[model samples]
Target: MTVPSPSAQPNSLRRRLMLLAVGCTMLAMPGAFAQEVAAPATVLPANGDEIQQFCTNIADAARDQRYLLQKKDLEKLQAEVDARIAKLEERRAEYEDWLKRRNDFLKQAELGLVDIYKTMKADAAAGQLELVNPAIAAAIVMKLPPRQSSLILSEMSSDKAAVLTNIISSASDSTTSKEPS
Candidate 1:
């Protein structure tokens, strides 16, 4: 005959457990019911050595996971820095091209302007320069030949001449070009 499974039994596990509890209560003396049942003793493992061992076993894995997360963060930051540097490099290249075009235009214009002033009479040139921007007048005077420049300065008012002289002198001064320490 084939044996039946525990679930096929006539009494279930809960029913059997309840019947056992009732039988034990009936067997006890009536005086025992009057006395309170003492609580079961509680047992605790000392110093938690098992918990410490479990933590120690997983320590290396936890540390590796932390390091992996930090590495990903650093890599992300590095990529951002690289992208910013690339943008700055592009801007610098554009700036250099613009500066070169500006300088080329200035050189061509400066040569033509100086030639026009040089051909003029010294008194007339000085009178025209007096009405121009002081910086432009000083630049033209600086570029002219020493004898021509002297003649033009002599024709100018003493105050205007002194100012031009100071500008020209300072423009050539090496100390002014040096960066402060």
Candidate 2:
């Protein structure tokens, strides 16, 4: 006839876990079961108290100076914002110029490649272009006069030729669309 331990009861683990969870939640909740305590009142200057009144006036002036300093800080912050925006715009313009120069260089290089490819045998040019970037291959084909492009495409595998044709056509369409009416 001995008393059974709590863990010996049915579903004891679940009950213990639930009790622990509830206890943790209660402890985690701020001011749970806490009593409210009143804060001590601040002493102020009494009527006709000269020294206390002077100190209060000085404090008020200091507070006003702090507010003025904050306004000055805001002005400085605005100037900094304007400076950063100017710098960002300058950087963006530089980036655009760099991109344009890079595009011009690539165009010249592509034209040179087209001349080289045109002099090669059609089958040889097609084989070399097959291993290069599809976009570059497509560009070279476009740069070649139509007769040479057709000969190169005919020499390529049908699937590769079809893909390059599609790329070239789409590129022309995009350029045409961007041009002013």
Candidate 3:
């Protein structure tokens, strides 16, 4: 093979060196440009009105949200209050019914007591000596008025009067014994 010329070899080496340098410079330029473009030194604001409008819009949205929450809370509170009122009304009605029943029972008891008193008074007047225990005699005496006690005593038999007097005396003695001193 023929040998290449020295001048041509030198020119080819120079061209390769120039191409490598140009490629490295092209890559380095893009990196530098990217860094400069990423971080700009200046900031722009179009108008104060735009920022004010944005803030007002945000505030209005927040106020509407709060109002909705408050309304829901009020509704819940009203429902709870209504339920409590209904419960209280039901309880009141039940209490009134209970009171009425209690009154009826008391009236019946009073009527029974009156009937028993009348029977005992009639028995005492008939001189039912066999039926008159101390307890029955005492109940008969208690039912009689203070002014009527003597009449009832006169109507009763001697044995019944004696038994009642003994019971009363024993009760008095027991009460006196229970004194502190």
Residue range 143-164, candidate 3, lDDT tens digits: 4565555666667677777777
Q: For residues 16-74, write the lDDT of model 2, one tens digit per residue.
A: 44445444444444454474433322443333453454455356545666788899999
TM-score per model over all chains: 0.40, 0.38, 0.38
Which candidate do you rate higher for lDDT, 2 or 3? 2
Looking at candidate 1, the ten consecutive residues that score lowest on lDDT are 38-47
**Over all chains combined, what TM-score does candidate 2 have?**
0.38
Q: What lDDT would candidate 2 get against the real structure?
A: 0.69
lDDT of 1 by residue, 78-161 (tens): 999999999778766766665565455345438667888889999999999899777678878877888999999999999999
> Clashes per prediction?
0, 0, 0
Q: lDDT (0-100) at residue 76 of candidate 2?
A: 100
Error of 3 at 3 (Å): 56
Highest TM-score scorer = 1
Show model 2 residue runs off by greater than 4 Å. Answer: 1-111, 175-181
> How good is model 3 by TM-score?
0.38
